[model samples]
Target: MENVMLRDVIVDDLPIFFEQQKDMTANFMAAFTTKDPADKVAFKAHWEKILNNEAIIKKTVIFNEKVAGHVSSFEQFGEREVSYWIGREYWGRGVATKALSQFLDCITIRPLYARAVKDNIASIRVLEKCGFEIKGEDKGYSNARAEEVEEYILKLS
Candidate 1:
């Protein structure tokens, strides 16, 4: 895989972002979300908030000179953590790992954290490859799944 770069997500990227998210959300719901997409206006609103917020570090993952995915770090419940997603087409090509590694390098803070759905092996592997250790597990409502799901917590020290 070519070097993956992380750059700030601009306003123009919203369309691509929305499409990728819709696809990922649909896939995630196969085993998780019970509600119809029609009832998920709030979910779209959340992404809009991320897009408009200046405090949240939103980034686009660029691979082979194209937008391959997104990665971000933000504060939640007083803790800073990272998260990312790569299009299914780009999976298994190291795009996510490379993008996340570069993102981690830019984070000066120690003890950053990350979380992944318990069943998402690929995401777990990506976090692990970036030096995040599994710290624990917790139950939370995943909007994509629309139900309480087990999630793994990872910490970088």
Candidate 2:
């Protein structure tokens, strides 16, 4: 489990977060990703906006005292949805499961929602393990893969 922990994301964490998201394999698995992962300017601008927003619940996923990735909640299409990213090097070993479990405890908003690429079993398993139930399914254009992909929608109520 690597003593996974979640804490408020700080400005210093942006570089690591950006680097992690740039991983081709991780972004492909996530499916829904920035239009250009390599665009540092865009990444910085995006994070700046997200971090400054008070309505968002953002956290850095720490493992063994190092930044493993990030987990956050934000509104999309009038729904409060959750999302997380785990560095490719730390994939598996239950990092995502532990981080989400801990993160869920800090968030009290009921009927929380989450989504994952249908083919991303690792992410689906993490959400399911944290008590998110499969609610529905939909298809969307995945910028990371540059194609349409099935996405699983889940909720915690």
Which candidate's lDDT is highest?
Answer: 2
RMSD of each: 3.0, 1.0
Q: For model 1, name the residue pairs that clash.
A: 32-145, 33-145
Q: Over the stretch 36-124, how does candidate 1's per-residue lDDT look in tens digits? A: 43434654677789988877887999888888878889997688988787776788899989998998888888788987788888888
lDDT of 1 at 127: 89
Q: After TM-score superposition, what is the CA distance of residue 67 in candidate 2 from its true location, in Å?
A: 0.4
Whole-model lDDT for model 1 versus the true structure?
0.78
How much does candidate 2 score in TM-score?
0.97
- What is the TM-score of candidate 1? 0.84
